[model samples]
Target: MSQIPLEHILLLSAVLFCLGLLAVITKRHAVVVLMGVELIFNAANLNLVAFSRYDPSLLQGQLFSLFVIVVAAAEAAVALAIVLRVYQHFKTANLNEIATIDK
Candidate 1:
């Protein structure tokens, strides 16, 4: 049986990262942007896990990936709180419309 190559995982992660960046740039909704950020985080996680699998001697990547997951969870909590506050203040979740707080 042929083993899957590490390059395949890296390529998949890269594609996901690019898509997430595009979503963050082009989406107008705050929630959509948040989702893009989550996607990017997951891409980094996939890369870490893939690297860990390819090279068993390096456990740091997996440990760092765990830390990343924790950080991502905390970020999501804070971001959701902010989004809720924005919705409460503006009565809308559109990123463009939430600029009223800029003053």
Candidate 2:
């Protein structure tokens, strides 16, 4: 099987990472930011899997990525729960509004 160049995979991952960072930075909605965080996690997973393809001996990279996926799932669950509670309390999911409410 012809494999894609590592550089290409890395570049794709970098682009995804950057886009996620931008969303996290520019978005005010809690849910949107959470989605951005997911994107970043996915980018990391992509890198891990890509590297593991090259080194198939132990598949440690794939194993690590699996752990990361589990952690990300847990984080997303907790974060959405918090967002739900915050929306109930503040009537808005905007981070700026939530911050102002705490003061």
Candidate 3:
């Protein structure tokens, strides 16, 4: 069976991670930041699965990826709940605007 090169997968993962980092660093919206966090999680998952495919002796990588996915889902739910509350209370979802402690 044909297989993808490890380098290609790693490169894609790196690009995804960089884009996610950029979004997390530059975006001011809470939702966008959450999405960026999800992207990073996905990139890590991709790497884990790719490595697992290369070495079939153990399925630890795939299992860990599954765990990460589960955690990411739970995180999304809680994070969205918090974001919604912040928006309702502050009248805006902008992280920069809501970051003020004096309000």
TM-score of 2: 0.96
Candidate order, TM-score descending:
2, 3, 1
The candidate, 1 or 2, that scores higher on lDDT is 2
The alpha-carbon deviation from the true structure for residue 92 of candidate 2, after best TM-score superposition, in angstroms, is 0.4
Note the clash tally of each candidate.
0, 0, 0
Off by over 4 Å in 1: 100-103
TM-score, every prediction? 0.91, 0.96, 0.95
With a 3 Å backbone cut-off (N, CA, C), the pairs that clash in candidate 3 are none
What tens digits encode model 1's per-residue C-alpha lDDT throughout 1-103?
8767999989999999999999999998999999999999999999999888878888988998999999999999999999999899788999877775576
Cα lDDT for residue 57, candidate 2: 90
Cα lDDT of all candidates, in order?
0.92, 0.95, 0.95
Instruction: Write the residue-wise lDDT of candidate 2 on 1-103 in tens digits.
Output: 8889999999999999999999999999998999999999999999999999898897899999999999999999999999999889899999998888878
Off by over 4 Å in 2: none
